[model samples]
Target: MVIRLLREQEEETENRGKKGPFFLLIFIIVFLSIFAFVFPFFFGFLYILGFQKVMGCFPCTGQSKKRTESGVNNDIKRKDQKKPTSGSLKVNSNGNLQKEDAAKDDRLSLDARNSNLKDQISENEINGGTKFAFGELVEATDNFSSNCFLGEGGFGKVYKGHLKRLNQVVAIKQLDQNGVQGIREFVVEIVMLSQADHPNLVKLIGYCVEGDQRLLVYEYMPLGSLENHLHDLPPGQKPLDWNTRMRIAAGAAKGLEYLHDKMNPSVIYRDLKCSNILLGEGYHAKLSDFGLAKVGPIGDKTHVSTRVMGTYGYCAPDYAMTGQLTFKSDIYSFGVAFLELITGRKAIVQTKDRGELYLVAWARPMFKDRKNFSRMVDPLLQGQYPSRGLYQALAIAAMCVQEQPTMRPAISDVVMALNYLASQNYDPQTHLAQGPCGSPSRTGAKRDNDKAQIASDGSVRD
Candidate 1:
């Protein structure tokens, strides 16, 4: 009712635009009052988010959801499900927690698995080279000392090490061997990473598997990750400029495209997030971490079924709810990551809008409303970027993260869209890199003013 009243008043004011300030003021005041009544959800959310710090854990930065994709009753359901009852399930301490931990042994065993990775990679070492031994790695990383550690993850701990033979730095990812799933994840990464080579992809140097230990070695990424650049920087550090942000996004898109149309039996990079995106000195982006990657069939099938596992906000709604994985699934994740890159915000957030609670859901509303879209541009850019570039990039993203899996753009297509968005720059040398970025910026880059041009569609042509 309030919305209808506001709409009618807006129409009246627009019709009365030639009249006067008094008329305008009457219209503005009435519209504001009506909007106040209509958008309480948005305002109430802002009040809680802005003023109420004690409201509990705000999931990520902008994550708020009334209903879960799990289909569990989010609303106050039955008395039985409202709260956990001790009588319903026994809470065992030492025994049960141990079993759960044991089940998670592989997922949690990164530290323990580092010791055995030498044996695993020996079999898969680059065609002809001295097989790396455990003693050599220990020495490279300062005898497995704390100073060499880069970061820890579910697979294992990554350490910076000096390769004696190569005389260069390397990143060693040690995997936990206690769980079979971890072992499987390790094997998949080993086989896939070795064969895959692209400029936008981190190189898989070697592997390590000794008894219950497993590890993955790759060329070290010196500049850390985009996540650190976007969120972890100090106050004085310059945020990623619009050009760098576009480059990073465009490069990552190329990597995804490589896994999609470019590869023989396409691989699905189910996990796409800021942390997995590594940067070189000049802010060149490389997509890494294939632990959750899936190699799927090529052709007319709409999608392939797989377990639903991915980072929270980056996961596509349909794929997360149903275990259907496809090349488009990765596109959806890229879309989320793209939005994060553009906004200089995390995919998750605590914010003023209820639907804006989740970045994607919140972002969709602004896309259709042209005025609202101006707000979507990251505040840091300061109007320096062209609005058309921002809209076109977001439009490509909007296509990627749509609720329908099939409707999502292919990673190859996404690369082209992003390219046009970046600068309409095209290079043949970059294309030979076979990374996703090499794709034509516009799938059908055309001249609008006078003539029609042949659409590149999927193939890049001069």
Candidate 2:
């Protein structure tokens, strides 16, 4: 230690006495240190401060940082949001990027979202988002009371919450966070799920990722999922008319097509089912619940290889047998969902004499025969749909359920076909051509109530 200290002292003394190259070298080293270690931060600070002052001169929006709204924007805020995309990169007169000045503001937004996710992670582990606080969620949800609860699923429960900041109502999905799938699901959502932009796909808002509680917040869907509307919900809700059913089918196809074609790597919704399809306030259909969604195969690779994952009854046969998932597999599942929408019966059910009755097995054969196809429409739909349209929809559904995924129509094709069905102008008077249902005395009605039910409008009674 003494030798090292003496060496340093001699070097300092030698440098102090030197007037030529040694002193010049010392001067260069000190100057280099100022530029390397100090100048940027020192100058950058002043630059940002000056930039902020300049930015402060701009109009201050009356909208508070803690704004909240439903999916719909209030009239005033919507007006303010409509800014002209002026072809200008915001910069200060000193040539510094304005983004730096607003770094603090951006951080505050991300921080609030992150905080919300953290607070809800304990009770639901769903990795919702952190913008909201535990107290905020309690206040929003009324402390997750029974009334705020929306629905329960295999993963966890969902609650309706109102965020004062965004002035928006959102669905908070609280999911189990311990399993491998749970964490993967969180990462998948954080990485891929977003606006999804397709008319048929659902919108995902921010998420929560605090501690052990995982929650996913989404735009509140007023009408809920087709699964509950068809079979589970209380009787108070209006029955899904034929037009509503067709619209749902068409819209869902459009969503799937957008994901398959427009998204960066293309996405495959592995789990497609009625339960995952949500309806907006106006009853437009949007496919939601992307926990099992995956990016499709990239260049040169025929398909992605992974362990099989998806619900039972809705899975395509080939996809189930092999761990291979493709876009067509999703279409196949759509076929099953189509049958569910048409028949109003559970996809898989086991009964006494009929050991096991799966919709695909029974509908496949019956759908081949026109008489049988007409017989399969839901009793609720009572011949309201045009027969030709029904035939086309059924044919598309049949094509989707083909044993080979490659043979199935692309979601785009399915979307187009369903769209045609949705647009068909089936006159209500056509039902009168089939006969009466209330008074059984008239045998003119095509068949019994047991026949695939038909609604007043011409849709897939089947």
Candidate 3:
């Protein structure tokens, strides 16, 4: 019984040892499982806390807040800056944006000014001229058709159009956007022509200003410009006779006289060339193209200071050199035009001979001698002009193109001389009766002697 009890005790001790190992294995397994699940979450929490602490310690958070605030302020500033006013913006932050804003402001200002001009036109402040619509002009010109094209000038292309509404034929000058003349010139022309009323001046019939299009309407000159008649005469066309030439010169001078003496403030005809002198039905000469006209200096001022602007050959030397424009400047240009009429040569001719290139330069030498006077007459005249008449005409042209502005004759004096010449009608029949050697007949000799006596008596000179 004692051996059996001892064996039971040993079995019980082995069982106890197995139970203790099993309990230990189960406890280790539970602890490992808990560590696997909880370790990741605890590490993540610690990592998040460290990341927050690092971000909080740096100044980037304040910088990010500032960037957001700056963006909002810029948005508010841009919205505030869009208001249009007379004063331009002064912004240092952005250059490209400032330029864009300035451009918008300029466009707005231009639109406002244009609106005012349109209102003035509607009120008839632009004289009795009509304000035409853009579409009307387009239709009248047949969409600026090539068939209706009359000519082109510095201003733009001209087209002959029949105004269906007014039952009037008109000459439409469409301004070139890329031309030297712009909105300022266009407005100046309208203002100048509207205030001027004279038979010797081309009438301003109407005008059109629409968006980018600018146009002027005038009474259609049937004979076109004097340049057409004088230079490049078409085939089988007759040259102007002595009387006709004198008449045109007198009329043009009278136009200048009216501008200088009649207008309240004298108007300076800055542009006076053959092309600007338009001929009417009876070859009546009238001054056109007042875009370059300027108001003369008032009171004691002797000359107007302006940028030198005119045809090169026709511009007065003093005006061209000094930019000091005077009424005598017009006189000088008139002298050039008269020279063109007398010689049928261009103001600046293109020829192989350098001596004959400039009409004034060529005529200056001829003016010094009486014998060269006949040579200066238009070869087209074929010696049909009278000797004394030629001398008197050259004298007038000579005094006109004097180097010194003070030496040039006034427009009134020029008018008197040209009027006398225009009245002394030249009979081509009487001219033809003279022999081939050009010996003066008794009547012709007597008439020449009388004219010489009269010219000597200061009728032509004064």
Question: Highest TM-score, which number?
Answer: 3
Worst 10 residues of 1 by lDDT: 449-458
Per-residue alpha-carbon lDDT of candidate 2 for residues 223-269, written as tens digits (9 for 90 to 100): 88888777754767666777788888887887788888888778888
Ranking by TM-score: 3, 2, 1
What TM-score would each prediction reach against the true structure? 0.62, 0.66, 0.70
Alpha-carbon lDDT, every model: 0.68, 0.69, 0.81
Task: Give the best candidate by lDDT.
Answer: 3
- The digit string of per-residue lDDT tens for model 3 on 53-129 reads 87676454443667758766777877877762332455566542343454434332343356455442322333426
Better of 2 and 3 by TM-score: 3
| Candidate with the larger lDDT of 1 and 2 | 2
Give the per-residue lDDT digits (tens) of candidate 1, residues 147-189.
Answer: 9988876677789999887898999877755432476577656
RMSD of each candidate relative to the true structure:
32.0, 17.7, 17.6
Better of 1 and 3 by TM-score: 3
Give lDDT for model 3.
0.81
Residue pair clashes in candidate 3: none
Which 10-residue window of candidate 2 scores lowest in summed lDDT?
Answer: 432-441
